[model samples]
Target: MTSEAKTVQEYIDSLPDDRKLFVQKLRDVIIENLPKGFQEGMGYGMMGYSVPHSIYPKGYHCKPTDPLPFMGLASQKNSINFYHMGIYANKDLHDWFVSEYPKHSSRKLDMGKSCIRFKKFEEIPFDLIGELVTKVSVENWIETYESAFNKK
Candidate 1:
């Protein structure tokens, strides 16, 4: 779920004590593995990583004023949401995660096309999450995004 948070710090600060540590840990993983050229900020009302407007002037296809989103992390009422655009756009990555995530966590891998949900902090698969984030760099994401949009 989205929040009215104006900054990443604000988003993190707003989380309750129970969820804050987990969110921070997840954020740490994303930032640690996130390649250069991707900036962390507030986007889609959640803490997000994006290709900076300076690097990709065209911005997001649906919202040109906003940077091209790479990933997002948020605390929801029921679960923590870890959103990955790389997984959403790439079939092999999605397939790999779907088939492999269960092995990493005994808990049910609650996921949508891109948003992986964890009901508790222990459910997060840090190694796999880091691997997924590092799979594509900002340059590759830009090229893939451009190619896909150009085709449309």
Candidate 2:
């Protein structure tokens, strides 16, 4: 659900025992694979990994005051969310994930444009998730974002 917590630790602590463990594991994977220049924080009421202002001073295109979002992990009302902005912006990556996920995961893939929803920890495709996180580097993300922004 929407977290009222102001910090990432606070958000983690707010989860139930089972959910806490699940999120923590997911968080660990994200952190381990995350590229340099991305920092962890709270964004949109979720635990977010973003391109900090020091790296991308323009901040998020939609909200100049906020950091540019890369990924986000949230314990939502119905499921845990893995939000991947990289996949959302790249058609090939998105298509690959959709095709490969089923082969790797036991649970049915439940996803949106950028959100992969896990109803249970067992539904998470940890290895695939790790690979996805590493697929786009910080420099690559900035280039992609700038290209899209220039097109607008």
Candidate 3:
């Protein structure tokens, strides 16, 4: 479920004890591997990593006042979801992740367009997620986002 927590720490604090560690570990993996220019913050009621306005002043096209979101992590009702915009915007990245998922986990990939659902917290592939985080830099994400969504 979406969190009402305003800050990343608040969001983490709000999670049940069973989820706190997994979520924290995932957050740590993302922060450690995240490219230099994306900032960690709360967006869309979840913990978000985004390209701040200073980097891309236009902000998100759908919500101009908000920073451009790159990735997000949420503790859903039945799963902990990881959202990556790179896979949504780049076909090559999506295909690569899809092909590589089986190498990391025995469980079938539970995914939506950009949201990867981890029903079993212990089964979450932190290493794969870390690698995916590094696959797109802030500049690359902005270019990809514009090319995919900002048609002239």
User: How well does candidate 2 match the true structure, expressed as C-alpha RMSD?
Assistant: 1.0
In TM-score terms, candidate 2 sits at 0.96
lDDT, candidates in the order shown: 0.89, 0.91, 0.95
Candidate 3 is scored at a TM of 0.98
| TM-score, per-candidate, Cα-based | 0.95, 0.96, 0.98
Compare the candidates by TM-score and give the number of the best one: 3
Task: Give per-residue lDDT, candidate 3, residue 150.
Answer: 56
Candidate 3: which pairs clash?
Answer: 1-76
User: What's the C-alpha lDDT at position 38 in model 1?
Assistant: 94
* Candidate 2 residue-wise lDDT, 43-110, digit = tens: 99999999999999999989999999989999988788999988889999999999999888888889
Candidate 3: C-alpha RMSD to true structure equals 0.9
* Window of ten residues with lowest summed lDDT in model 1: 120-129
Candidate 1 regions off by >4 Å?
none
For model 3 the local lDDT of residue 118 reads: 99
Q: For model 3, state the Cα shift of residue 123 in Å.
A: 0.8
Model 1 agreement with the true structure over 60-115: per-residue lDDT tens digits? 99999999998999899999999997788889889988998888889888889889
Which residue pairs come into collision in candidate 1? Answer: none
Rank ordering of all candidates by lDDT, starting from the highest: 3, 2, 1
